[model samples]
Target: MDRFRDRQQAGERLAERLVALGYGREPQVLVFALPRGGVLVAHPIAQRLGAPLDVWVVRKLGVPGHEELALGAIAAGGGRVLNEEVIRGLGIPAEAIAQVEARETQELLRRERFYRGERPPPELGGKVVLLVDDGLATGATMKAAIAAARAQRPARLVVAVPVAPPEALREMEALADTVVCLKAPPDFRAVGLWYERFPQVSDEEVLYLLRVS
Candidate 1:
């Protein structure tokens, strides 16, 4: 709990641990940060490795009545991952997905413009793509992100984060070539609790980081 005093500190710590993990040269590596908080953790990492840092926007589909529960998630490039189990068992109609998609799609486009401006996403066709997020909770959103990224045909996919529940980490491990999470608390309650400073990352910050760093 006292390991990091704040998000910046946590980012530094994660970078140090990652450097030790030996993923190789920063310039050659392609690092994708999930905005907006993930960018905060990833900036230090990108700085350390001299890698080009960019944001990968992904949004979750909240269940119709239970917003906290993820019914599915969607990512860029027509990438989608649906909880088939929920859809079949809970009887979520297509109308529900359509509604969620409409709302989430608007935000996704807005974020793309807000975070990337005119810059285009880097090529991931044959490079090691390191996906960074502040932390993992339900694993739903990241799952969609990873699946979305994989469609771009990156040679390798790695998931990096500062903290996540052990179960979530394990689920992610199978989805990615590797996982570089710094801490896996058994009883991880929430991503915020793991961080000493978990302030809400702003839209301007995401745009700024993508532009300069």
Candidate 2:
């Protein structure tokens, strides 16, 4: 089982792969990290690719009782993606889904303001946009991010992550023009399990990386 020492190491490895694939050679490239974990994973990629780094804030709408189980996700620019399978399988009602979306939407907006401050989002039209995340489990959040990026009419939308389950990777491939995942273990259970040290990223760290990049 391949394991990453930390998010930084994972980001370095992903950056190497991106460079090998002829990325980072162009000026019309923009990298969007899904904070606060994705910010660290994306920093190295942005640095190596010489791409301007930014955050695409998205909030996972967890099920009311089971907060870890993602019901859907809402992103900045009013992009939302719902898991119909999960909602129908759990017999969740519209009222419940609406409530969850409402709560997460507020947090998403708050994070966008807090992280971005007065800086306007970059122009994605006709640019190669890379959406980076630490890892993916259900991929709901990345889906929302992709939807938001697609609305902006990027020339190409790429989904990059260090590790993800094969099923989740397949789902992302359908949404993005290209998917760059370092590891897709079939028996993958959780994103944290593949890492030696997976800690919750703080807002301060996210702000620092954004400022530096």
Candidate 3:
């Protein structure tokens, strides 16, 4: 709603909702945020909940000709997702997928270095993990992140975002243990639209946030 000036405000609102929903307790409630927008959001929530804040890097694999359209996604440690419909519709060969994944993997590593430096990933096993993002569209990257988290055997996996398309929000529920989206508009064009100040978050900014936290 208009209550959120940006992701930070949205996260504060979301944290209040979470506390109301009964995730107010101890060590099990961990917040894992995707950079760079999610970091801003997660910071407030982590402080409010006394939860450990961390990052989970995942990148989208965009389809040829429609770079905005996700063909699938990939996360660290080789976790991957493929959109069968996009692949078939675009006639994207298996080799093509491999090529995209390969490139994206490089970008993923770059992001991880930019955002994480030498910090290790937090323990996820047996924890009630809440994954945060600014928003979602195809949800391919978030799906991959969920898969990666599942490997760590979290007690529960929750996907939370400030906004998303209604259809994408539904799809996210199938992957995570819970979905906590603030808005799911039918006319959801992009994540930026929901915010008044959706500035481009540079890699420098990402690194700065990581450093501060």
Candidate 4:
């Protein structure tokens, strides 16, 4: 496919692919989406697979003075992953990393509260967990999510996305039990580039999708 019309279309395509791969047949399937964009993309997957949907809140830890550069990421339930190579190469101090992590942790907690409210988190133990995201760029946030999900002892961990660069897909393959990606274009620039009508997903949209799902 050249490009998806939007996140919904991309999600429909992914859901179809997953069904073909026999994921729809899996009995104890649970879908966890990374908000706020991933939730929209995962809605169709959850519907197609007849699974419960939940959010896995994660926040990226950007490098000091260069926010775009990801130093690592943190997930709900206190799961975290840091790139020692990046920290060592950039000579980032522990204090700076601590400060960034603290700020992100607060944001993660806020999202968990706002998106989930009083709803208890899904039970992942012995369930086939399909962790869905809109797409992967650096894969830092997804890695953190995987780490968090692993702690819950899911029977199988699958990372699914609509589009990603080849290198990012390869990295994810090593982390999760299975990785399903629809398109891995060689000239991949960004996740938004793979969708023609990409737009910023708002908190309101996230709330609506979660409520319906």
TM-score of 3: 0.92
Per-residue lDDT of candidate 3, residues 55-173 (tens digit): 88888898766777899999875678899998998899999888888898999998787667787777778999998989997888888888888899989999888889999988988
Question: Between which residue pairs do clashes occur in model 4?
Answer: none
**Cα-based TM-score, every candidate:** 0.93, 0.98, 0.92, 0.97
Predictions: Cα RMSD each: 1.6, 0.9, 1.7, 1.0
Task: Give the whole-model CA lDDT for all candidates, comma-separated.
Answer: 0.84, 0.93, 0.83, 0.93
Provide backbone clash counts, one per model.
0, 0, 0, 0
Kindly provide the TM-score of model 1 when superposed on the true structure, using C-alpha atoms: 0.93
lDDT of 4 by residue, 1-213 (tens): 499999999999999999999999999999999998999899999999988888999999999899899999999976799999999999999999999999999989988999999888988899999999999998999999999999989999999999999999999999999999999999999999899998999999988888788
Residue 194 error for model 1, in Å?
Answer: 0.7
Q: Residue 150's C-alpha lDDT in candidate 4?
A: 93
> What residue runs in model 4 are displaced by over 4 Å at the alpha carbon?
none
Off by over 4 Å in 1: none
What does the lDDT come to for candidate 1?
0.84
Worst 10-residue lDDT window, candidate 2: 102-111
